[model samples]
Target: MATHKRAETLMDSVCEDMEEKPEPYFSFGIIADIQYADIDNGYNFMKTRMRYYRNSLTLLKEAVQEWDSESTKPKFILQLGDIIDGFNVPQKTSDTSLAIILAEMEKLKIPFHHIWGNHEFYNFKRKYLMESKLNSKPLEDEIGQLTINEDTSETRSDQESFYGYHFSPYPGFRFLLIDCYDLSVIGRDTMSIKYGMSLKLLKEKNPNEDLNSPRGLEEEQFVQFNGGVSGAQLNWINSVLASSDEQDEKVVVIGHLPIHLDSTDAICLAWNYKEILSALQSHPCVIGYFAGHDHDGGYSVDASGIHHITFKGVIETPPENQAFGTMYMYEDKMVLKGRGLVLSKTLHYRNGRKEEPVH
Candidate 1:
């Protein structure tokens, strides 16, 4: 029920000045954790939160209609993963559910990017995901295939089963779409190398037989529901950031798991988030990271001055409410045109870090 109340209040205050806000250089739609399923609504784990499984589809439709009505439509849209719920597979409605949602996004007729989350692995296997549209390998018209330093290719293959890629919409702005579950237990087959790695780590870190339970764990990240990036993926990201630095480009990091511990509950954090945060801090070209997975949502500005935003999940939003926004980027600030649970805000950044808030 509580959605990071303090941070939400602070962000709402920062976003209150949109009345005199200047024209943005670019605008992009933002939505996350749709987790859509055709089944009746139900409660979340621990039965502590209600989820509107059926109503989420309607919420997405509302968001699209709002985006279409905008005077200046977003150049693109970002769907921060969990487009469909894991329960869809058990009920045998996964394909239909996914298509119904994708159809709405297609109506916008603009490019959109997808980042992978744990739930995606719940429904689809690694091989299937590689061939799926969720791979961030959009067409040339939707998203151009940029050269991500180190000769990393976007070609679909069993070898590159994970969905980590970088693209530059404009010459000076780059988007790093990370595959947070690159090393996880659910997506790859139990016999796969990645799965073995995940199981080994989970066994070593979590003593509970129920790997998903975070009980009695000092660092709750060992839970099976969360995942992490492998060294190979990390190296690739380093290369991309290195290239960004050389080109004097500013990067906006996008992922499904909330990496900054302060910006998300410990249980919802990724496995190797400290390493991920360290990697991000090393790159002065990075401005912020956007994510989902934590239903209540969260916000924090790390020591390096990077913004970490965990958007509220559409499923957890009450049946009568919605969660989405359009981020308007300016020379010195990023403004939020939020609807429903998302708060509107004008966050200012200087040399890759945000201005310290005056208490």
Candidate 2:
């Protein structure tokens, strides 16, 4: 908790020094948890967080306009998932909700790389999502030259999309997009192996019949709203990390669910995050992890040099406010230029274990 606070305190001062920093190698815009719907604003099930379902689309529109007007225009935009609210389906606005959000996103003309969140399951099934536009398919001029001879990543396979694909915008640097919900109960048929596995895990960790409730559970990650990384996906992550290591490239992982306990509430983490976190920490090439699930965002650099940033949720922002930013990737550090509620932070150490303070 002290590390988290100290990071934020430094972020408050870092923005003013941006003019003095070296030129960034590349830049990209980031926004998450738009969670838009056609319904009016309402409180969450626990009533601790109020969601502005309708106004989030407007926020996206403004964010799009802001990004479109930027001189350096991001190489690509990372839509960190939960693009539409879960309530949209029960509210009978799933189709229209998605259409409007996509329309707003289309205005930017930049490639959007999306992460799959649990709210997405509330709106659409996994089969549909496999071929959806939300999947971050690498675009040529935007992402660098293809390194792989054969396409074996997420978008190519219609049956299942456990993509551990790398988006190389700059040489020796990659954004590894991971699928955290590959083994989840949400949107999966009850009889499916993945679904069974998720159920068994949840039952063991959480006693509540209302699976979403994390009440008595010591480890809150067992809730139904969260998911896990499958064994296949873990292997893929390792393979991609090995490939990136061989190529001498540094990687920044992008996903929906937060993997670090300190980076987010236990309720918002992946079930098998310990395993996933171990994989990232052990890999010297893996420098950072970006995600959104906890509406109240968090930041913390682990004992390892990896920087974990859970972006603030768009839906959590009031209609009058917004949460978005542009991330500038410098050779030695990454700087996030926040627009509204998102704070600008300098994650300085990318590769070595010699941890540095947030600037």
Candidate 3:
């Protein structure tokens, strides 16, 4: 595959004839549930997690270096979600774990986008039930927001602690980073007076059957509750795709969990066949979809022509949290090259047209 250049002339030509324009390709690092945390000293989980970060970072460093040499490296990095396992742990501890992982990532020198998984939702109750101090209006009207610093450190204020759901500037491309963890559709800074009504209902009724067990909820219920990239997110995605179509540019979608897994039986349905297939059918410019959830790596493309990729785990040992290599986009395809202490270019993807080992 030829490495497409992003020079103004090429971009202009591509923009002029999107159909004729060979698909624009990018190489980015995708991983989920790094769940960086200090486990019980006696437990082997922490030891394995520590190694995952070390090895994954090592591979990422190499990929970034190679791309950096080319004028067009990656537009940025995408972390599907679960950067850390326990969102409710003491903020101090979470901060320390995050710092360790993010600090290492800073060396890459590219914007890192993240999504908020269920584990990241901590103050959902209080923030919704609180009084108004941050704003004159009640909390329900406010939108949750969280900013992931370039260094990978996260600072969240309850008023708007929604993480990593934002826009990135790209020529002919619009990128939306959503914080899927924030389940409530309303804001939380104002007193329960406004948005608290729903919070109260949820507390009393507990709509989520698995509120007690984070891992127990069915994928379908999860998606029905907060899975599909619809509502504000769907609207945002549609608008971006529309804009791209009007300009005749390629539009790419990224999320922590694939649309398939986001709304079905996580184990049974390896991919979101219906919803994703439909979306791609409707939006043709949507050239690719990248996600990380199932620790083991896998890839699938539906009849509608959408590619779904699940990268390997970073932690490669034990009952959970195994080690895995990183995936990158090369030319018109995405590449999954081996990383960590172990090395093999066994896993990866090409553009929408090809499978792993893009070459």
Candidate 4:
């Protein structure tokens, strides 16, 4: 609870400084893990995540509208990932959830971009949907006239669907919506990680068992991950960053997973947070990395000036699932803002008693 207060103070401090700045600035909203549409048998099924998240969205919309009523709203809105627990549920359920979220985002009237989460693959591998290896035809055959630009299409329906990373024409900043999960083919190393015990040991451990048994690990903890940016996707990310560097653009990398964990300093190399940090450190254009997945709120700073932030989850139940927000680069000082919303009254009381209230 005391922790939540600190988070709120962080947000307020950031907001206050922005207000004091002489130059006009833009601010946007990010919502994470609104795993909408689970009828039953799941944590946030049957629109439970949606119910709480819609409220948060409403609050955010009102705030943005009140702040910028006369002109265009902040450059855009970003839905970080786990928009739906697609990997764990039926395709229709997840798709419907995505549709609802898309509708809500549309009401904001800003260009919204979505990042792919591990769940968006209908509880399957992300690599399958990345390249054009899948069986489906292009969007023209499936959803005709739904696409706005055919010539500028970055999406390949036959492969994994990518909403494309979005960028603002706004000065001094760029947002990269990275597709960390590859859905085309499973690599040998990735298979090893997914299986946990390693391929060599698989035969030794289950000598008499079938070659492709359940692998003894539960579905929830399945690996099926490639980890860091590698191969073609890595090249793409580098190219994108290089282009941004050429233009002297300040970048804020947004993804679903945390670059570093607050509980432990373990760095997951598969996603390349460390490598990404190292690469972005020399560039004045790279400000920070914003992400979710840990559901805990904290900021980590390496030897370099770059900042990595893990945002709280929106669908976490009363005591554990409380939601929050953070602001960066809102002013000259790059103050950070944090806030706690939809908390349990008991938890609030416990937290409130521990902290000094802002005047």
TM-score of 4: 0.59
Q: lDDT of each structure?
A: 0.83, 0.81, 0.44, 0.46
List the candidate 1 regions with Cα displacement exceeding 4 Å: 1-21, 139-160, 352-359
TM-score of each: 0.88, 0.87, 0.56, 0.59
Q: What is the C-alpha RMSD of each candidate to the true structure, in Å?
A: 8.4, 8.0, 11.5, 12.7
- lDDT string for model 2 (8-62, tens) is 8888779757757667888999999999888878997789888988888889989
lDDT of 4 by residue, 53-148 (tens): 334334444434543463535555556666655432544554455555556656656554566554554443444434322211121113221222
Residue-level error in angstroms, candidate 1, position 285: 0.8
Give a tens-digit lDDT track for model 1, residues 1-359: 36689888878877886545678888899999999999888999879998999899999999999999999999889999999999998898888888899998899888889988888888887777767777666632243334455534433446445677777765578888988887888766876677888889988899998999998998899898899988878888888887777677778899999999888999999899988888888888888899999989988878777788899999999877879999988777788888999988767664754333321
The 10 consecutive residues of candidate 4 with the worst lDDT sum are 344-353
TM-score of 1: 0.88
Better of 1 and 3 by lDDT: 1
Clashes of 4: 26
Number of the top TM-score candidate = 1
